[model samples]
Target: MTVFRLIITLLATSILGATEGVVTSNSVRLTDGETLASAMDKGALALNMGDVTFIAGYRQVTSIRQDPIIMRFDGQGSDAVKTWQRTDIDATAVDSRAVGLIWDGYERLYVLITVDGGSNDAGTVRRFTNNGWLRDYGSGGGPKVTVALRVDPNTGTPDTGTYIRARLSNGNTNSAVPTAIAFHGDTLVVQLSSFFSPLRVDRQRMTHDTGPSPFPWRVVFDPSLANARRSEAVNFDGVVDIPELPSRQVRLMVGDHEDASATVIVNQTVVARPSGSILDSGIYDPAAPCSFQLHDSIPSSLQ
Candidate 1:
């Protein structure tokens, strides 16, 4: 999908037989100012002359210089998702993450990562051109969001959705709720799943307000996917097999738990404001003097 320009020898240090040839330290590289997002999203490729080291599913999370303490990319039976080999700067490996897409603009392939959130990790969003230069942005190489198909809120038809892959949060590693997500276009929608909080209006609260959702509404899987937009068909189990796709454009509100995390996922192009945005904000006011339900329910998760 991308080509190599030049690469740093150090970047090649992690190549355990994964590239065509190893990029030596003497390799000239592009300037650092070129943002990682622009490079990968633009179509940059690292220098991998011809080594078969790059397998489909290889991943890890830990300190780069300290060796990976955690890694995963194998599939379960026939349902496992395939992945690419990613090697960003050593310091960029501070958290659990995965490289999703690679788009290069200037004779290089850009690289992006999906990071795990926690008390220690700030999550990541690193980028590297074909030559293996590093540029950090969009969380620590974190995956952006993409694609969503919500209801009409009134008729329950195909309202519309966005595809910001960066919106989904998997730091839960066990399916925690992504607080908010952008639509397939340029909107946001969120689902408050299960949590330990008793005061917060979670799924139960959602049911009390509306009725129920097709699924639990808050239970999402935390899988290792790079460029979710490109691989969404596989994850969503709704499309045919395809090749690596363009990177998604989205962001995650950093934190954990209710008083800690800010995970959210949008299913449409309209921002779900319990209260609208600042211009006419009054949708989320539990005490607002308004008259609107805002949502409908399905048959599940209703107790």
Candidate 2:
């Protein structure tokens, strides 16, 4: 039997602090002060709606307190193109179950929702970004849920756009466990189990299982690189440092912005990937809350 050992190493690049990235929450008071003409409490889709706000949660069938809401923009100024709010849709390249609507630019409004919630697990992620509606991520079968899909002009069309995730498989929520997530070169160093030495997964495109469903796992492989970022932080007097030696996956809840230092809570979870396989474009489907692999750049040694 030929045993293959793959090594991944994320260099020790200490980021100054947490950078500006998208975070998930139940409700948000639009600080923009832009009073929407009307607001509906749908699900997570409410965030992308135009001239609208406050989407209500009708069928939040999950125990999690923070449920996703969908918002919609009425068809007043739109170029006669936009999904109708507070209405049901059929399975198509545009709107339906397992399908969604991702707002692209001035001429784009995507609708991603799933129609067949059964074994087929068919879903679509289509949008009108530049000029017409296009398929971004199609799903055959996997975890399904509607989430606020946030992306830039480049990632607006799905197909591994910005590498979105519902949750981090290797995360920390424990007070006693000390965790760390450091970026080295282009790789991400996930240190856990001090005695076992720090483990690293090379920069690759992989999918992470982060949905309201049962199966939750992290998948990693030498896929590709889309983008990368770096951040650093300082601990306060009472702040707890790494007590257990080495670990990865630490979550911090920053308080008010005025505070010089933020409150970072050490999350306890070892992120490991048993399969080092690269993901093809067809492996992932959009409109569902399934996790996915992010193609990132890293050192060749780890690959």
Candidate 3:
């Protein structure tokens, strides 16, 4: 009877809400010469819970050296409750910076990190649980690697079976770092500015047609980070939740376009583009009034 009671208690805690509040924002406080990975805006709380606050930013170790650090605060806000820095965990000489933070709404805190891969950036994601930093996710108990880049030779598609973060393209002019990350239900959504085409140039740099551009890439992974469900380019602005909406589906705002039209994404697969007639002429603005019509098929122009 005691063993049966223990099992029931464990199951309840596994799926129960452990915290009273969970808040996340790109706006974070920074000192002189300090910067965030990709701050959405400036001057706001990064992440706060009840009385404790967490901020992800850089610490200037020296005039030439900077390291990523997460500062925790208690009541006073004058001093840090705890400082979780990257150098404290990884002692390597490689250049790494903590860019962003994501809360699973549970006990796990995912840290979005980027390491300098020669001239470009290589993305890596790690998690902190009750047991502390998970150092055993990699080979021989190394740091956890969330973004993997391994493509098949023939098909040129990501091969999941033998994926590794170390296999990502290095020494590229363009960055392969993850710019943003958010949780879409049980799935983890990560955004990369560019992935495969390292030498890709815009219209300003006129040249022969290079390989296809795999930019604005979005990748979805399960909770365990063992399998990648899908990886492809997307047109959504960012991941957000609509408090007024009744549905529980993930809301992805699609407001980045040349015209006065915007798209909407409820699931990772479907996309809905608003009609131009319904919107006034001008560039698409997320802050403006808008509506969308769900279609069974995506327009060929967008595809």
TM-scores vs. true structure, each candidate: 0.20, 0.24, 0.42
lDDT of 3 by residue, 53-105 (tens): 55555545566544445544443343433433233322134344455556532
Model 1 CA lDDT for position 241:
25
- What's the lDDT for residue 139 in model 1? 32
User: Candidate 1, residues 1-303: lDDT per residue as tens digits?
Assistant: 222111101111110111111111111222223233333233333322222111111123322412111111223323433232223222334342222221111111212222233122322222221111111222333222211222221221222222222221432122222222212222122222222110111111111222222122211111111112111211122322212211222222213211111112233122122222211111121222212122342211100
Residue-level lDDT of model 2, residues 1-303, one tens digit each, is 322221222222222111111122233322111223323222232433344322322222333212222333434333322232332122232222222332322322222222211222243222211111111222332323222223222222323211112212343111100122222211222211111011122222124222222221221211121322211111211212322212122211123222112211111111221132111111111222222112232211211
Least lDDT summed over 10 consecutive residues: which range in candidate 3? 2-11
Q: What is the lDDT of every predicted structure here?
A: 0.21, 0.23, 0.35
Give the runs in model 3 whose Cα sits over 4 Å from its true position.
1-45, 62-64, 76-80, 83-87, 118-174, 197-214, 234-303
Pairwise TM-score winner, candidates 2 and 3 = 3
- Ranked by lDDT, top first: 3, 2, 1
lDDT for model 3, on a 0 to 1 scale?
A: 0.35
